[model samples]
Target: MQQNLNYVYPQVFWVDGCTSASASSPSAPPVTPFPPPVPDRRTKPGHNRERRSVGFLVIFMLILLALTGVGLSMFQIFHLEKELAELREVRSAWPEQSMEKEARKAAHLTGNPTQRDLPLEWEPISGHAFTDGIQYHEQGLVVNETGLYFVYSNVLFRGSICSSQMLTHIVYKKNPTLPGSHVLMEDKGINYCTGQKTWARKSYLGALFKLRKMDSLHVNVSKIALVNFEESKTFFGLFKL
Candidate 1:
């Protein structure tokens, strides 16, 4: 005895959607379709270039701001250093000046024509003449405090006739350490006037000097009679610095 067997295969159907129908039946099942894939807007070349440009601009601005901040900080540091240096200088000088405030050496003397001698004499106590922490004796200014001093002198010369002579004026100082007087300043006039005629001339001397205690300063002229004794015209002065 023999037996007979049969096999059946399923069929597929294509439509607008993914639905299937069987060969043995007319009805089919419906399937939901997936939405269309969205276009990739970020993939375009123009949009990529625009994004890159914005990023570069932001980075450049940030770098510029950082550089400006650093420059301002350096300038402030330099300014502070300069101010500190000036303050240090002032503080260093304060002690010396404060100690000598009460006994500061200063003197101003007017000319005295009555005392006609080799080295010209001065009136220490008359008319606009004064001495403080200094001494005037023997036709000279005596230094009592040792330090820097600003020494100044003015002399006026007048004559009824011109002698065409060389006129010399000198300021000198004498101290115990030196054998002779050391000349500090000098002025000379040669052939200033010719023939017999009324003429006048003036010589002025002023400078800073390191003076020592007990140093005596004197003014000498080639001709003492030629010097004018008017208080304002001829004068000598000095002040401690």
Candidate 2:
């Protein structure tokens, strides 16, 4: 066959009549089988949908765990608070606590605190002689049971906070200070407790009854004389012996 002059191609022809393409432009090599899919699932096609770096994934999971832990802790706290409220309600329903609160209030209102031992304002009587003795007096003697006996001595009878005020207070004893008393002398002027005496009233005899029984001064006065209050009067100190 004649050569086709219109196609001056570079293909080599074999002298034996076989035609061959040039090695430089040989047919493409057959494609090797696609590489086996990577063993790691991370590189799969679906992974590209919302890809995350390995470090970022780890960080996100850690953050979720922290949030879950915080939520759980808050739930526990609220649950404990609820339980505590329930317990308080149950306690308030009990009767003994109400009684206890009332008892505490009563004790505080009426009870004297035992913490301190203060001196009592009371004093004891000398004896029944002071309690059941009759009233008597002597002249020029203080008759410490002195009463409004002397008008001039009334100035000395004035009671004052200052001891220098010459104020005199006479304390007396009576056998029976009751109304309708018969205060007889133990032996006339020999009955002078401290001697000097002025006029004294039988009513003042009740002072002895109080001192011996309650150990307290029922008649608190700053003057020495036959002073009267209501039906009571200051008395002469009784002298028995």
Best by TM-score: 1
- In angstroms, the error of model 2 at 14 is 32
* TM-scores of all candidate predictions against the true structure: 0.58, 0.20
Predictions in order: lDDT: 0.88, 0.32
lDDT of 1 at 52: 99
- What lDDT would candidate 2 get against the real structure? 0.32
Q: Any runs in candidate 1 off by more than 4 Å, and if so which?
A: 1-99
Question: Can you write out model 1's per-residue Cα lDDT over 8-123, one digit (the tens) per residue?
Answer: 55577666655566656545454456677898766689888999999999999999999999999999999999999999999999998787686688999999989857788999
Tens-digit lDDT string for candidate 2 (37-78): 567645677566446566689899999999999999999999
Every candidate's CA RMSD: 10.3, 19.2
